[model samples]
Target chain A: MILKSKVAGKLLRIMLISSIIFAVISLVTTFLFVYNEQLYLKIYKFDQFISVFYMILYYLLIIVYLVWLYKAHKDLVELNTMYPITPKGALARVMIPIYSLWGMWNVYSTMYDHFRPIKSTEKLGSQLKVFIPFYYFLFLITNGLNRVLLKSNTGLYEVSDILYLVSYSLDLILLFVFLKMVNIVMKALDLLMVVKQDIIDDTQDVSGQPKVSS
Target chain B: MNLITKIKEKKEYSLAIILLIIPLIAAVVMMYPKHEEFVATGDITSVEELGVEGSVYFTYVHEGIIENLYEKFSVSLTSRNEIEFSSLDQHQYENYTAYYETSDKYKHNTIVNAVQNAEVKTDSQTIKISEKSQKIMEKSSDYIGDSFGLMIAIGLIEEWNDEDFSQNNQYIISGTGTIEYDGTVGSVGAIRHKLLSAEMNDVDIFFVPKDREYYADKNFSNQVEAKKVVKEEQLTVKVIPVANLDEALEYLRKLP
Candidate 1:
């Protein structure tokens, strides 16, 4: 029972964190609406409100999750006291909220950027499956460079820095799209191999099982 | 158990793999630099070393103010910010008179000496002057107008119009070097020295006179001595009926 409860708590935390990440990204993008003015002055005004509402809803959900997290911890502590579960396991369950929040915050901005209107919405939606990890790697590289440059007295030429940042971002986006394509092909191959194996195994399995010599 | 065979025997995903590779290849090729010459010339230091110089031209025109033949039209020249010239109108046959004085009892004849023995040609007198002269005229609208305070309208045209130039032919004007005067002629003299020191190239100006008899030997940019067909007194030194840029300049100089 203690183990089951701990797994359920982890799953809940992951779900809440994912939702928060989505909400935070939507909010950040909404605020950067000024950047979109150049593409078309007439943006759908409701986009901003929708993002705001989503953020609020996510925050509320997070609060509810925190309450549930507290209850789950309490229940785990009781379970640990009654059963053979260790104190470490109970503490770990209690700390899942913080880990989840941290994970959500780290990736929220990038995930939100995938939805920007510059690209075709449908294409971006499909591409983002690959885009996320690709962009994470790109961000790590660029952010490291940014920090190194910050230490030097000779700051980067503003235009060059901006251009580099944009280029890196674009490269990541392209890589993400490529990875997504690869992922789809791999999945299709896996499915086909499974089906072929299943057909072969269907005939072979009955004999191999030493059929219940009933 | 036979992973290698399974991978090889699986229907080749050739279409999907090729589709993926094409875009990747295209992107890589497109990202390479395009224009080699422009990239080579992108250095700005050399371009800055080559000096740039320009001239300002001013063409003065007036109308609806010619009461008597001698009563010349008063013209005021100004810049975007301040007025530069305010002179009394005068008419002339051979040479007009310009009365200028520096002081209260001051007496001065600001003369625009004519190019002696030089024949003039050109329709608009202003066009025959230096390149600087043309530049000043082109920017005249910026210098003129009530925006700069003094609204000195000489004719119905609020501003100098190229269309009116051929009609009256009585356009009073003058030309001077754009020198920073430190309140003295000595400073003006210094300007000439500086210009010469820099080895500034002159923008050649020519005038094809209506009466070609004003010159015996005719060549562009060549100075010549010639006699005037009309007497000095009979010749109207007014800027009106100015043949070309050279004639206009000569007429301006002849004005007292």
Candidate 2:
């Protein structure tokens, strides 16, 4: 299940861009609902339609992202046999509910470490160590607040509304951070591929054979 | 490196710089206050229909620091059958009043005098408060601070003038401030939250104490803070600073 770095990078870029778009739309819709309740209610059907459409698209995108992540993890596992988690374990960690929060950190950390050895020039691994944990914190808090909001019937709707809005804004910020992280990972993978090809070329040269062209 | 590789590296560097700058730009945009236009005119008819047509609706200044910029609430007069004095959520009125009664009797006397004045000024025979109103006051005790007594007094006055409150005014009026025995409007905290609440309720005019415009060591005045919040939230509610209850009433009376 070795995924090509190029394909994986492209997938990550797509995910990043799409996530940004989705976040922007979510923020705009939230603001619309907050600022103009009457107008938003009048177009409630259309708003619901858009929300459902985005939910479906988001789930589909997450599936694709998870698949790409699994493959990337597999590649890293093969490259680093002494990796802490096996490819199967990494995938399971990410898929399982509640565990996924910690699992995501594990997966990203593993990916970061695997890429670190191949490309020492980019300190992306250290950056991910910070960004990934911070992202997870924001993610957990947002989801936790959302659950609280759903269950509570206390007449403090305004307080809950403020909390929800703050959570959502934090989520938007996490998206930006996530995109930067993906970019760093993609760059590392690109460098790793280049480094691996150079090694192969050097070996061919030493074996008295002509350099293999790409 | 080959020429193609060099060109690619340059492109990537440029892209990275742009990516790094995006979040910084977003932070600046969010923090920098934008100017907003506020319409002073409100639909008085709509407010009247809410059964508080002539009632002097008091808005609470939600000054507690909040992360959400778009939180919404409204000003409304809850009809009550009886008036019950109660403590605020976080701070007990007795602690402050009792302490002031002995240690700082001047401040305590001022508060007591204000409450008494508000009561005496109101036609209490016709005005009454309900349990729901008491609950709302209790819930908002933290934001309303020690102004609960003054608010009750104003509520009674509004209830008394319920018939003539909206007769001359065409715009809905909402306000946050303490009413004194001398008809002076004292400054309150959380003007930003109160302004947003008024806007959420579609209030036309929000009255604040003119003296609240500035305080020691504060960068922005109450009016400026209200404007900034209004702009940030993209609300269309107007904020008017008043020196006293008479000024607020005069402004409301002048409304077409």
Clash statistics: count for each candidate: 35, 5
Residue A9 in candidate 2, Cα distance off native in Å? 4.1
B1-256 in candidate 1: lDDT tens per residue?
Answer: 5866654454223322333344344434433322110000010011001110111112221211122211121111111111122223333311212211121111010010111111122233442223422332343322211110000111101122222321233332212111111110000111111112122212122111232334454421111111121122232322122233334434434534
lDDT of candidate 2 over A1-214, digit per residue (tens): 2345445456556656755776677666677677878877787544444444444455645665566566665655554467677657877987899899778787777776665555462487777777887777877887787666554433234344566567568777877887777677666655665665576678677776877768
Share of native interface contacts recovered by each model: 0.00, 0.00
Misplaced by over 4 Å in model 1 are A1-41, A77-214, B1-256
Q: What is the TM-score of each predicted model, taking all chains together?
A: 0.19, 0.42
Could you tell me the TM-score of chain B in model 2? 0.46
Interface RMSD of each: 23.7, 13.0
Residues B1-256, candidate 2, lDDT per residue (tens digit)?
Answer: 8876764665434443444344444434433322221112121122122233245455643222111111111011111111122223324434444543453333343345434554455565533334323443444323314433233344444555553444554556566666565776666555665666677677777666677345773445665566677788898877777776556656655765
Docking category of candidate 1: incorrect
Docking class of 2: incorrect
Top-lDDT structure, candidate number: 2
